[model samples]
Target: MRILGLDVGDKRIGIAISDPMGWTAQGIETLKRQSKEKDLARLVELIHTYEVDTIVCGLPRNMNGTYGPKAEETRRFGDKLQEHFQIPLIYWDERLTTVSAQKTLLQGDVSRAKRKEVVDKIAAVFILQNYLDARAKS
Candidate 1:
């Protein structure tokens, strides 16, 4: 089954898609958020295009394993998405996915501007891959 992963933020939402077998995740695009209506519209288009059966969203929990404001915002957004699409939604703890993505880009010698452009999508990949890995192990 194809799965869509999202790293949601106030300004932009990172997008990723899993392979049909759910063995790998690929970065898609960084969606610039305009409004709730617009964002959901764009997501609906993606979900349809990719034939996504499940959604894995990154929850920005604190390092101490506590939910913070950002996590709450992500949950709210996920709730809206679920209400709109009626799709199964799963939240993956994403504490340092962005930092990990940034370091990976730096290691690859990507320029700052390029990193800025792709970091979100990369983070989404990390989130999705982690979830896939954990599920596989279990």
Candidate 2:
């Protein structure tokens, strides 16, 4: 099944998608947040474009396994998404996906300016890939 992954943050939201077979993940784009309505509109368009059947949202739980304010915000966003789309939504632990993405880009010698633009998307890809890997093993 086609799945969409989201790395949501205060300023931007990272987007990723899985193949129809759910074997691999691809970075889609980083969306700069303006307003909830606009964001939801764009998400709807993407969902239609990709024929997504499931959504995996990054849940930024603390390293010690406690839900912080950011995690609460993510849950609120997920609630809105679920209410709007009525799709199966899952929250996957995403402690340091962004840091991992940044390191990957740095190792590739990507410029700092460019890395800022794409880091979120890359993090989304990592989050999705990790989820796919765990699912395969189970």
**What is the lDDT of every predicted structure here?**
0.95, 0.96
lDDT of 2 by residue, 13-97 (tens): 9999999999999999999999999999999999999999999999999989999999999999999999999999999999999
- Per-prediction CA RMSD (Å): 0.6, 0.6
Q: List ranges where model 2 is wrong by over 4 Å.
A: none
**lDDT for residue 95 in candidate 1, whole number 0-100:** 86
- Candidate 1 has an lDDT of 0.95
TM-score of every prediction relative to native: 0.98, 0.98
Model 1 misplaced stretches (Cα beyond 4 Å): none
